[model samples]
Structures are given as C-alpha cells and as structure tokens.
Target: MWTVGHSTHPLEDFVALVRAHGVHHIADVRKMPRSRRHPQFNVDTLPAELGSAGIGYTHFAGLGGLRREQPDSVNRAWKNPSFRAYADYMQTAMFAAELDRLIALGAREPVAVMCAEAVWWRCHRALIADALVARGEPVLHIHTPQRAEPHVLREFARVENGRVTYPGEPELF
Candidate 1:
C-alpha cells in the first residue's frame, strides 16, 4: 500500500503519478473531496476521470482528517494541534474499522491512499502511515512520477499491542 497527494496537479499528471506506483485502486482519504483550486479533483468528476484510466477510486470518509481534538488527548508529541487531534481519532473504533477496510482492499489490489497535501509529512497520511506500519504493512509515500519513499515510523511514535501513540514526553516515547 502507498499514499499520494494530488497537490493541485493536472488530472493527467495525477493519474500518471499513481500509475507509476502500480496503484490500481485509490482510496481517497479527504474529509471533503472537493477542490475549489483544482476542480478536476472534485468528487463529482474524479471517479469518472480515474475510471477512464483503469484506476479505481473509493472515498473513505471514515479515515478522513480534520477531526476535533479530544481535550484530554495525550498525543502531545505533535505540537501541531491538527496532528494531535488526528492521533486521538486513530483510537476510535470507527478508525479501526475504516483502516481494516483499507487493508482488505489492499489485499485484493495495489492501493494508494490519497489526500490534498503535496507532502506526506504535512498531511494526516503521516499518522495513517504510522498505523499501517505498526500493523506491519509496507507504506510508501509517492513524491513524483518517478520517485517514492517508503514511510518510516516517526521518531516519537510508540507501538504497543498493534496500536501507535505519540506521547510527546521524551522519557516515555
């Protein structure tokens, strides 16, 4: 499995980007699959566009970002509030079910999870990648048509019993 970002690319370029990674299915992980800046990626048109290219598309809103942070979140390793919030969301049963669905899809096909951010490190896909890695799934972050880097667990990430948590405290991580 892999993760890619459309990043305002033209439709053809985005398709090529996924094709380069042998991704036959794209599990769109955007909370809202619309792009005012790049309408070509809007949900209404993307499925058809990707279909013509022989790549499948499915929107996994359950794995979407922009979640609200729990006031009691312990994922302080992420100074960025959004990342901290998303880490908390990962603990939900909803997230586990959604992630299981994604893993099942990957078993049947080469899957690429995608969002809007150009860089994986800056996207919620980073945390998603962490969860995947903790489960022993290989995840690569696609950077270009010819370049992809395998995801490495973040420095502060701690995995216990197949769950990953980022406790900011250096002593515990």
Candidate 2:
C-alpha cells in the first residue's frame, strides 16, 4: 500500500513520481476528487491521463476524508478536529468496506491511495495508514520518486477489533 499527495506537482511530475514506485493503480481518496489548483487531477481528466501511462485509476469516495466528528468522539489524542473526526469515522462499516477494498487491491496490484496534501503526517492519510497498519498491511508514504518512507503507526493509537482508536490513558495524561 502507498499514500501520495497530488501536491502542486505538474501532471508529468506526478506521473513520474508514481511510475518511479512502479505504481499500477492510483486510488483517489478525495471526497470530491476535483482540484481547482490543479485541474489536471480532476476526476474526468485524471483517469484518462493515468490510463495513457498504463496506470489504473479508481476513486474510493468511501475512504475519502473531511468527515465530521461525532458529538461523543473517543479519539481525544488528535488535537485537530478533522483528524479526530476521521479517526472516529475509521470505526464505521463504510470505512471498513473501503479499507477492505484497498487491501484487496493492494494484494492484486501496486495500489497507492492519494489525496491533495503533500505531506503524510499532516494529511488524514496518516490515520488511514494507521488503520491499514493495524490490519497488517505495510504502508509506504510517497513524497517524491526517491522519497517514499515506510509508515510508522502514531504512538498514541491502539488497534481494537481491527479498528484504530487514539484514547490515551486518562490516568497517564
């Protein structure tokens, strides 16, 4: 499994970056899968572009971010509301289905999950990677052709029932 951000890289550069990792499938994990800053990454154009390069493209909107935090979210370790919300959503059946799809795809193809952020640590992909890690899937975060790194699960995360929760020990905190 791989994570990539469509940062401001030009289309060719982005293509080259994925090709460098021998990526065969690009999973767009963007809720809207459109980019105003980089119109080339918009859903319609992206598939054709990737196809021309022999890379398959699929949009897994179910795994997309921008989730709303539940009123009673248990993931208090994430100070960022967006991160907390995504961590909370990771327990849902929808997330599980999408995650299963991603894992299955990884088993069958060189799949990379993508969003718009440039850095994995700051992106919701970090939490997504955590869930994947818990499931025994090795995740790699791609920064550039020569800059991919193995994922390390966040220190505060705990896996339970194949899901991730960041409920830090109250007594310790």
Candidate 3:
C-alpha cells in the first residue's frame, strides 16, 4: 500500500504519478474531500478524472483527520494538538473499521491512501501508515513520480496488542 498527497500538484501530474506507481484505487482520507484552492482535487471532479485514467476513487471519511483531542488523552508524545487528537481517534472502532476497509481494498488491488498535504510526515497519513505497519502491512510514501519512501514507524510510537499509542514522559514528583 502507498500514501500520496495532492500537495498542489496539477491534476494531470497527480494522475500521472498514481498511474506511474500502478495504483488502481485511491482512498481519499481527507476530512473534507473538496479543495477550494485546487478544484481539480475536489470530490466532484477527482473521481471522473481518475476514472478517465482507469483509476478508482473512494472517500473514507471515517479515516479522515481534523479530530479533537480528548481532555485526558494518553497519546501525549505527539506535541502537536492535531496529531494528538488524531492519535486518540485511532483508538476508536470507527478508525479500525475504516482502516480494515482500506487494507481489504489493498489486498485486492494496488491502493494508495491520499490526503492534501504534500509530505506524509506532516499529514495524518503518517499516523495511518503507523497503524498499517502495526497490522503487518508495509506502506510507502509517494513523494513524486520518480521518488517514493518506505514508511518507518514513528520513533516515539508504542504498540501494544496491535494498537499504537504515544505516551509522554511520566510525572516526576
């Protein structure tokens, strides 16, 4: 499986990148699938464009980001509030279900989870990649038409019982 960010790429360039990588299905993992800045990546247009290139598109809002951190979130290692919130959401059944769906799709065809951010580490796709790795699926971050990187689990991530968490330092009395 792979992850790609639309990242301001022109529509043709984006489609070419996916086609070059042999991605047959694209699972849109953006909370809001439409992009005002890049109308080509908007939901109403993306599917048809991808279809024209023989690629499939599906939006998985259940796996989307823009989550709120719980007041008592245990995944504190992520200093970024947005990242922390997403990490907390990963512990929920909704995330598990959506992740399962993504995995199942990947099992059938080459699939790439896509978001808007250009870099995987800067996007929630990094967290999703961690979850996929914990589930034994190798993931690749698609950087450009000629460049892709293998996903490495976040250094601070802790996985137990197949679930991942990022705990901050213990309180010092």
Candidate 4:
C-alpha cells in the first residue's frame, strides 16, 4: 500500500502523481474530507476528479485522524496527543475491520491512502504506517510524482502478534 498527501498539488498534477505510482484506488483518510484552502480535494469534487482519470476514490471516514486521547491512554510513547489518540483508536475492532478491507482492496490492485499533510511523519499517516507495518503490509510514502520512500516502523513502536502499541515508562518524578 502507498500513502500520498495532496500538498497543494493541482488536480491535474495529483492525477498524474498517482498514475505515476500505478495507484488504481485512493482511500481518503481525512476526518473532514474537505479543504477550504484546496477545494479540489473536497469530497464533493475529489471523487469525480479521480474517476475521470480512471482511478477510484473511497472515503474511509472511520479511518480518518483527529482522534481524542483517552484519559488513560496506553500510548505514552507518542508525545503528541492527537497521534496518541489515533494509535489508541488503531487498537479498536472498527479500525481493524476497515484496515482489513483496505488491505484486501490493495491486494487486488495498487492502493494509496490519501491525506492532506505533505509530510508523512508530521501527520497521523505515520501512525497508520506503523499499524500497516505491524500487519505485514509494505507501505510507501509518495514524496513527489516521481519519488517515494519506503515506510519504516517507528523505533518506539512495540509490535507483537500483528498488533502495535506505543509504550513509555511512567514518569519517576
């Protein structure tokens, strides 16, 4: 599976970029599938834009980010509350089910997870990549239309039996 960020790319360039990577389907993982600054990526128009290029688009709203951290979150390794909450959500059955569907779709054809952030690590895409890694799916991040980087699971992540968690020692102070 692959991940791509809209990153201010024009609609035509976005189409070409996915085409360059041979992506047949796009799984949008944006909590709110609309961009005030980049209207072309809004749900109301993104589907048709990609469809016209013979690419498919599906919004996986359940898999979107912007999750809230639990009061007793188990993912202490993530200093970012948003990321920690997303990691916590990854432990849910809902997330697992949706992820399985995505994996199956990817097994049939090239699939890329779409989000709005241009940088993978800076976005919740990094947590998703870690989950994908734990699930044994090879994940790559599209940098440019012509370049991509292989995803490396975070060194702080703990993976066991295809499940991932971010754990840190409790504060001594």
Task: Select the stronger candidate by TM-score from 2 and 4.
Answer: 4
Off by over 4 Å in 4: none
By lDDT, the candidates rank as: 1, 3, 2, 4
Against the true structure, candidate 2 has what lDDT? 0.92
37 Cα displacement, candidate 4 (Å): 0.7
| TM-score of candidate 1 to 2 decimals | 0.96
Clashes of each: 0, 0, 0, 0
Off by over 4 Å in 1: 170-173
Better-scoring candidate (TM-score), 2 or 3: 3
The positional error of residue 126 in candidate 3, measured at the CA in angstroms, is: 0.5
Which parts of model 3 have CA positions greater than 4 angstroms off?
171-173
Better of 1 and 3 by lDDT: 1
The better candidate by lDDT, 1 or 4, is: 1
Query: For candidate 4, what is the lDDT?
Result: 0.91
Query: What are the per-residue Cα lDDT tens digits for candidate 2 across 1-173?
Result: 89999999998999999999989999999999998989999997999999998999999999989999998888988889999999899979999999999999999999989999999898888999999999999999998799899999888998887789998645444
For residues 1-173, write the lDDT of model 3, one tens digit per residue.
99999989998899899888889999999999999889999999899999998999999999999999998898989999999999999999999999999999999999999999999999999999999999999999998878889998888899888789999786567
Residue 15 Cα positional deviation in candidate 2, in Å, after optimal superposition? 0.8
- lDDT string for model 1 (17-114, tens) is 89988999999999999999999999999999999999999999999999999988878788999999999999999999999999999999999999
Q: CA lDDT of 71 in candidate 2?
A: 80
Worst 10 residues of 2 by lDDT: 164-173
Q: After superposition, how far is residue 127 of candidate 1 from its true place, in Å?
A: 0.4
Candidate number with greatest lDDT: 1
What is the TM-score of each predicted model, taking all chains together? 0.96, 0.96, 0.97, 0.97
